[model samples]
Target: MASSPLGRPTRGTTGTNRLRRNDRWIAASAAFRRADDPLVVDLGYGASGVTAFELTARLRRTRADAEVRGLEIDPVRVATADAQLAEVRAGRTPFPRDLRVSFARGGFEVPLADGRRPAVIRAMNVLRQYDEEDVAAAWRTMATRLAPDGLLVEGTCDEIGRVASWVDVRPDGSPLRFTISLRLAGLEHPSIVAERLPKALIHRNVPGERIHALLTDLDREWDRAASLSTFGATQRFLATVSALREQGWPVLGGRTRWRLGELTLPWEAVAPVAGP
Candidate 1:
C-alpha cells in the first residue's frame, strides 16, 4: 500500500480566523495572483479544515477560480474536515455551498495527482514541531512540488491571529523574504513576534543573530514612535516602519501595507547567523 504521510501530527489546536492574516498575505502575493493554475495547498491544516475554507473565500475575491486543498497528515483529521466540507456543500454551514475547497491526506510532500503543481503551498505553523535542522530539507521537499513560479509560505502565528511571521520560499527552495504581521490595536512592542517566529528562525532570536537584531531595532523604533500613538496605532506603526526604512532596514511595501501593521524584509536581513 501507500506509505504513511511524511510529517508529524500537529498539536491540533486551531481557532476561527487564526490564519486570517496569512490568507490575506497569500491573496495579495504575486504567486497566487499571477498563477496560471491558481491552485493553493493548505498543508497541515490542523484538526479542522476551516482554514482552508477561509483561505478559499479570501482568495476567490482576487481570483474567482482560486482553489484550495487542505492537506493533513492525520487521516482522522482529513475525515473530520471531509465531514465539515459535506456540511458546507449541503448549505448547513456559513461557507459558500460552492466554495472551491477540498480535504486530503498528505504532508510536506504535498501529493497532488496527475503531475499537477500548485501555485502556492501555505504551511503555517506546520514546521513548528520539527527540529530547526529539519527545516531546510522540508522546505526543499515542499518547494520541489510547486509550479515553476510558485511560492511556499511557511511560518507561525499566535492562536488569535494577531502576531505572525513567515518566510517566503521560491520553487527552487531558496527563501526570498521574511515578514512580520501584527495587530496594532492595543498593542505592545513589535518584538512580541519573536515568540512566534517560524521554526527556522525561532531559536535564532538571540544576541548576535540577525533576527534578534531586527526585533531589537523594531522595538526601538516602536518606542521612538510612542508620541505618534496619539494619532492612533496605525499612524504609530506607519512611523515606526518609516523610521526603519530610513535607517536602511530595507523594508518592503509602502504606507498602505505598513498601516496594516506589516513589515517585510529580504530574507538575508533576518536569516540565521549560522544557518536554519
Candidate 2:
C-alpha cells in the first residue's frame, strides 16, 4: 500500500461482530452487490481487525471474491491486524484460506497502491472525534478515492451494535440516503436512533430540524403502533414504518428489510437544513 502521514490515533475500541449491522446493510446495498470490482475498505477499523474479518465473511456470502482492506492510522493496530492476517494465512485461524483481506496504515487519504479505488468504503465511528465542520472535508477526501460509482458508508453505532445509522454517499460526496438499523428486540422507540446518527445529522437533531422532525414522527408512529407490539417488535416496527410511509415520511425498504429493524429514507428527507 502507498504510504501517507498517519492521522491522529483514536481510542480504537472494537469487538467481534460489533459492526454486523453495518456489514449486513452493505451486503444488501446495490453498490456492494452490483460492484464489478468488489473492493471494500474498512477505514479505521479500530484496535482490532475482527470487524474487518466479520465484514469480509458477511460480504463473501454475496460475492466470493470480495476484498476487504482494513486501514488504520495507528501503526501498532496495523501490525496487530497483519499478525492476525498471518495467522489466518497459516491455517491457524478459522477464516477461509482464500480470504481476500489485508491491513495497512492509512487514514482519510486511503493511500492504496496502484491507484486502486475501492467500490465501498465503510468508515464507521471514525468521524466522531473530528469537529462537525470537518466532516464534509473528510468525506470529500474519502469520496475522491472511490470508484466512479462507489459509496462511502460513514456513521456511528453503539458498542454492542444494537442501534446503528449511516449515510450512503456517492463518489462526489453527495449523500444518497440515511438508514437506521436497530436490534428491535427491546427497542423503546425509533427515535433512539438519534443517539447514533451520523455526525452530519446528530447535531441537527433538534427542534424544527428535518432530522429531529423525522425522529419525532418516528417515535410518534412507533407509539401509535404499540398495539402491534403484542405480536413482536418486528411487527411493531413494520407497522410503525408503514405508518411513516402513510404519513408521507418517505420510508424506504420493504418488509424484508423492515423485519431486520431497518428503516431508510432519502437523504433529502432528513438532510440538515440551515437554522435550528
Candidate 3:
C-alpha cells in the first residue's frame, strides 16, 4: 500500500495455536506490561489471522486495553482475516465479540492510518525469505515505525511451533537479546533449533560462527546434564542452561524461564561474524 509491500508474499502457512509460545512471551514482556500505549502490530500474520486474534487475547492478560493490528502485504490475506473478523462480529464464531483486533494490507512500513506508533511489533517468520544481509534494513524500517521505548520481535519457529528463537530489537534498530524456546519433551538436543534461527543468524550457523559454537556447547552441556533427566526434561534443561551461564554465556532470565525450556542471552553472545 505504501509504494510497495517492502517484502515478498509468504506461503501464509499458519495453524491454530501455532504462535502460542510467541504470544505468551509477549504477554510476559515488560514492553507489553508497561506500554504507554497498548497497540501492537503482528506484521506478516500469514494465510490466517488466527495468530493476531490469539496475540490480542494473550496480551490482554497483562494489559486489558491491548490491541493488535494484523498487517499483511497480500490484500487477499487481509480480506480473509477481515472476513473472519466479520464472522466473529456476526456471532458466527466463538472469538470474543469485542475482541480488540483488525487486519490491514501493509508491510515493513506498517501503514496504520491512525499514524500512531505501536508499542510492540511482532514480525515472526517474516524475514526468513530474504537474503541474510537484507535483514538489517528491514529491521530498520519496522523499528523506525515504533513508539519510543517500543520493541520489535523478529524470529522463526518450527512448523509445529515446538522450537523457536527470536531477536529483540529496540526502536533505534539495535538488537538487545536473542531468545530460544523449546517444548523440552522428547527434545534430543538444543541444536535442533539451529534450523529455526532468526534470518540474520540462520546462515551464520557455520562451524566458526558464534551461533554454531553456542549450539554446540549447548548440546554438550545438555548431554552432561542427562543425569538430571531422572527428575524430568525440565530439570535437565535447567541444569544445562545453568552450565551455560557458569561457562560465561551471558544467559538471561532464570529458572522460571529455563524451566519452560527457554533460554535468552544478550545479542552480543550470538551475533553474526562481522564482514564477508
Candidate 4:
C-alpha cells in the first residue's frame, strides 16, 4: 500500500483571494517564469481549492502553460477540491473551463507521479501549527521534491491577502531569501508582518534576533517617512524601503516592487542567530 500523506490536517480556514498576494509573487518569481515545465504545486491548500485555481489563472497571464496542483493531506479536502474542479470543467464556475489545475492528497512529502517535479511549491500557512523545531525537516522534505533550480515558498498570511511573508528555499533545502508583502493603504507599521511571519522566524522575533532588529529598524523608518504620507502610502513605503537599503539592509528588487509593498532581503539579513 502507498504510504500515508505525511502531515496533519490543516485547520481548513480558507477564503476567496486569501492567497492572491502569494500568487502574484510566484507568478513573477524566476522559478516559475523560467522553468521549462512551469509546474507549480499549491501544497496544503486548506479547505478550498480556489487558491489553486486562482494561482493558475494569475500565472497564466505570465505563462500560458503554467499548471497548478493543489495538495491537501486531508482526503476530504482533496475530494472537495476535485468536486470544485469538476464544476469549473463543466463551466458552472467562473474559472476557465480549461483551467490547468488538479487536486491530490499530499502533504510535505509532495508525492507526484511520473517522476515529475514542480518548479515551485507554495506552502502557505501549512506550518503555523508545527513546532519551530520541526521547520527544517519539513522544509527539507518539501524542498527535495522540487525540480532543479526550483523554489520552495513557505510562509504564513492572515485571513485576507493584505499581510503576508514567505521564505524562498532552494532545492537543497536551504533558505535563499525572506520576503514580506503587505497592503500599504492605511498601514500602521511595516512590522505588522511580525504577526504573520513564517514558522521559522515567527518565534525568533524577539530581542537580539536579527528578525527583531529588522522589524525594529523597519518600523523606525516607516515613522521617519511619515512626512511623506501626504504623497501616498506607496510613496511613503518607497521611502521607507529606500532608507533600509541605504542603511545596508541588503533589500532586493527596485522601486517597481517596492511600489507593491514588497521587501525582499537575503535570508541572512533576518536569519535566526545560532543558539548557544
Candidate 5:
C-alpha cells in the first residue's frame, strides 16, 4: 500500500545544475537510449526551476527531441517554474519545444496535466525528509508512474552536488544498481558516502548492516589502492573498484564509470538494509 503520506515540503535550497551528475547518468542510460517517448520529471525540484531547465539542456545533447518537466507540490513553485520555462516557449531560451519543459502542482502520485507517464523521474533530495521506513512504498508509488522503459533515479546529494549516491530503479520498483559518485581528488574514503546516502541507506550505516560492511570494505580497498593516487584520483578509484569486484563483491558497472569517480554494485550488495 502507498503510505498515506505526502512528503513534507523541503527548504527549497536549490541552484542551477545541482543535479548534473544524475542528469548525465540518465541522459546516457540504456533506458533513455531506447525510449520512444523521452519525457523526464524533476520531482520536487525545490524553490528554483533552474535544475529542471538544466536537465532539459543536458538530455538534449544525446536525444535532441528529449523533454523535461519539473513537478512540485507547491502551486507557487509550479507557477514560478512555468514562468521561467515560458521564455523557451517565446523562442528565447534556444530550446527546442515551445513548451518543451513545463511545471505542474503534484505530489508523489504525479498528477499530470493530460494523463502522461514519464520516461525518467529524477527525484533528488525529495525523500530526505521522510521517515526511513517510508522509502520503499514511496519508490513503488513513483515507479508505477513510469513509461514501460522508464527509470526512477532516486537518491541524495550535497548542496553543490559534489558527492552523490543513487539507485537506478525500474518499473518493478526494484533497484538495478547502486552508484556512489564523488569528487575524487580529496575523497578521503568511499564510505563517507554513508553520510549522504539516500533516505534508504542513511540509517543503515551502523555496524552489522550490509551498507556498513560495504563502506568498510570500500575504505579498505581505497587504502590498499592508495599508492595509485599518484596517477590521479580517477585511476585510484578505478583500481579500488576493480579490487572490490575481484574480491567477490558484486560490483556491476565498469571502468568507464569508475574513471568518473562512480562505482556501481548490484542492488543485492546493499539490499539487506531494506530486508527484515
Candidate 6:
C-alpha cells in the first residue's frame, strides 16, 4: 500500500520489548479487550516488528482474536518489519502465537485500505519528534482512523520500557484519560513519571497548568507517604494515590491499577494550556 505523508519520517529507533508497558496496559484496557473486531494499530513501531508482535501476543490473551498492524511512515521500515516477520515465519521456531500481525506503510492520517478502521490505534513515541504545538493535530489525524467505538492510545516512554504515560482518546478525538506507568521496584518519586506523560503533558509539567499542579501534588504526597516506604515503595505509591483521591482530583481507578505503578486521571486535569 502507498504510505502516507501527514507526518514526517522518524529515526525509527526500535528495540525488543521497548513498548512492553504500553502493550500491557492496552491489553488490559476495556477499549481493547472488548473491541468489536479486536483490530489494533501500532503506530510508528520504529525499525522492527517485535513491538507489534508483542502487542498481538499480549492483547490476544484478552480478546483471543486480536490482530495487530504496525504503521510506519517510512516505506523502508515497513518493509524491514515485513522481512522480520517473514523470517520468523519461515523458521517455524515455536514463536509466540501471533496469528494476526501485519506491517503497513502509513502515517498519522492512517491511510488504511478496505475501510478497515482499527479498534485501537497505539501511537507510541510518534509525536516526540514533533513540536508540542503539533500534538493535537497528530491526535486528530490518528483518531480519525478508528472504528466508531475505537480508541487512540498515544504516548511516549523511555528506551527500556520501564516507564510510560499515555492518553486514551475516544473516536471523537477527545482525550478521556491520562495514565502513568512505572517500573516501581526502586522508584525514587512517583512524580518522576511526569517526564514520560506523553508529549502533550511533558512540557506542560510546570507551574500553573493542571498537569503541573497534579505532579506537584503527587510529589508532595509521595514525600508525605515516604513513611510507608518502610514497607516498600509500592505501598508508598498506593498511599500517595489514596491521598490524591482524598484531595478529590477526579482520579480514576484504584489499588488494582496502583499496584502496577499506574495512576490515571481524567483528561481535563492535564489538557494543554491556551497559549504562553
Candidate 2 lDDT by residue in tens digits, 87-199? 88898887876789999888888888877889999999998887778888888888999989899999999999999999999899888899999999998878888888898
Once fitted onto the true fold, the runs of candidate 1 whose alpha carbons sit more than 4 angstroms away are none
Ranking by lDDT: 4, 1, 3, 2, 6, 5
Q: How many clashing pairs in candidate 1?
A: 0
Candidate 4: stretches off by over 4 Å: none
Tens digit of per-residue lDDT, candidate 4, span 1-276: 116888898899899999998999999999999999999999989889999999999999999999999999888898999999999999999899999899888888898889899999999999999998889999999999999989999999999889999999999999999999999998999999999999899999999999999999999999999999999999999999999999989999999999999999999999989720
Please, what is the TM-score per model? Answer: 0.98, 0.96, 0.97, 0.98, 0.92, 0.94
lDDT of 6 by residue, 96-181 (tens): 63458898888887777788888899998888778887887778878988988889999888888888898999887778998888
Candidate closer to the true structure by lDDT (higher is better), 5 or 6: 6
Candidate 5 or 3, higher lDDT = 3
CA shift of 218, model 6, Å: 0.9
**lDDT values of the candidates?**
0.92, 0.88, 0.90, 0.93, 0.82, 0.83
Q: State the lDDT of candidate 3 residue by residue for 1-276, as single tens digits.
A: 455777888779898888888898888888878888889999999999999988987888788899999999999999999999999788887678788999988999888776799989999999988898888888889999999988999999988899999999999988999999999999999999999999989889889889999999999999999999999999999999999999999999989988888999999989888821
Residue 193 in candidate 2, Cα distance off native in Å: 1.6
lDDT of 1 at 34: 96
Question: Candidate 1 residues 18-86, lDDT tens each?
Answer: 999999999999999999999999998999999999999999999999999999888889999999999
Model 1, position 132: C-alpha lDDT score: 96
Off by over 4 Å in 6: 92-94
**C-alpha lDDT of candidate 2 relative to the true structure:** 0.88
Clashing pairs in 3: none
The CA root-mean-square deviation of candidate 1, after full C-alpha superposition on the true structure, stands at 1.0
